[model samples]
Target chain A: MKNIFERNVSGMTERLSRSVIGIAGCGGIGSSAAVSLVRAGVGKLIIADHDRVEPSNLNRQYFFFGDIGEKKTAALRERLLQINPDCVIEAYDKKLEREDLASIFENADILIEAFDKAESKQWLIEEWASVFPERPVISGNGLAGYGDFASLRIRKTGNIYFCGDGKSSDASGLCSARVAVVANMQANLAIELIMNKTGDVK
Target chain B: MGKITVNGHEIDWNDNMTVRNVLDRMKYSFRMLVIKVNGTIVKREDWETFPVPEGADVKVIHLMSGG
Candidate 1:
């Protein structure tokens, strides 16, 4: 395992291979971010979602036709392992409840909020922060419609870090290209935090 | 008695000004927002009750994406 990762990846091998990330919601953002982190050599991931893939998810989510009936967390775990066979993935087959966050994601170095509903997004963020005040929560918001790619951005409030234009409502429409951009940005920020976390070499 | 700032703009602050009141004053009807008052996060459920004192620095982030 070490030999394969050594050959495939370059810098921060020791750090990434030991890190653990937690993600809530297995939609486009969560699915894509998990893949990118695994490719970047993140050692473990804990993903959860209560929904099953439907034909509609193909528009932006990272799932195949065969994954249509599979639960999102289960399907995503399979996909992540396919990329890094040794990478540890703990997939829960249910939506996250506020009370389950600390116990489920206690070891997560960082948390990602990828839910679609406005209320869900707000609820998870605040709940997670209340439980893990020291950890950061990366969120995706406002990547909807067309020709306003610049509308998407990143913002930080205390322990909460979010990415979006803060104006684009997904209810109106969500473009694949824009969603991918924000997903990658969230993944990139996660990498940055892990790499720059001041002596986190475990 | 004094005023508070929201996203760099000054708004008149009054007694018993909660986070919800500020949102209404600013006309921020967006559903996905990350609000903070003086660097302290104000949860969505607490919007109606979280206090925003005079001269408090508030951040009302308007989130644009859903998933």
Candidate 2:
């Protein structure tokens, strides 16, 4: 059998290496999705999250207690690089505004909207559609409390993937299991988009 | 009237209705959700131009996060 890196993907990996994806949040859904995309061989990843890894985040977020107080985007970048040394990971420990959206999204083949705020998520949907109409953006939702993994679904709005319901993360209580499941769903949708596999929707 | 299903709920659809337009008609609050039409996922870009055919089965799943 061929070694993993030496394996032939016929430029699939090369093309993906050249591709850039922007993920707005690095919390529950964002962090988890980032890990998956890294493992999937996505070329480049841009993570933007102003929040720091907190003790509370240890339960659901990917960061450890040791990483507490560390900016989510920065920590995620370090971790992802540890796994895929060649992958280019960028970290932005700041919020995204209308002007910054374009720059952040520039050259990215796909955009993953994982912001914790519903308003910001809306901003991505509108801005990407109006300004960068050709680019594909995926927004996540409904990953809160303790719910069955079956509840999560992936649907396409145009080129954007709306990965869940607008269910408030504040619904009752938040748990790691819920966030992990939804984040995986979001990551799966992104991979499928990158692979051009659209025969099925999850 | 055309018939279609959204998020498991069946509803009436109008002629030449795009997914975004239908979403608006249903007051789906698009920001909080994703829509699936006839097993194919429709993204935000296709909302205005993508047409929903008659008797098409559509599903709209909305996401919510609980604290």
Chain A TM-scores, candidates in order: 0.94, 0.86
Please, what are the lDDT tens digits per residue for candidate 1 over residues A1-202?
A: 6665666445667788888888888998899999998988988998989999999998989999999999888889999988889899998898788888889998999998888887788778888878888888998877776677766678887878888776778778776778878888898898888888887544
Across residues B1-67, which tens digit of lDDT does each residue of candidate 2 receive? Answer: 7687776677888888788877887897646544557756566667778899888877666555431
Q: What tens-digit string does per-residue lDDT give for candidate 2 at A90-165? A: 7788877877888876767778877766656655666776676666788776666776666677766667676754
lDDT at residue A137 of model 1 (Cα atoms):
94
Tell me, what's the RMSD of every candidate? 1.9, 6.2
Model 1 chain A worst lDDT window (10 residues): A1-10
Chain B in candidate 1 has what TM-score?
0.93
Per-candidate TM vs. native? 0.93, 0.72
Highest-scoring model, lDDT: 1
The two-chain DockQ for each candidate, comma-separated, is 0.70, 0.24
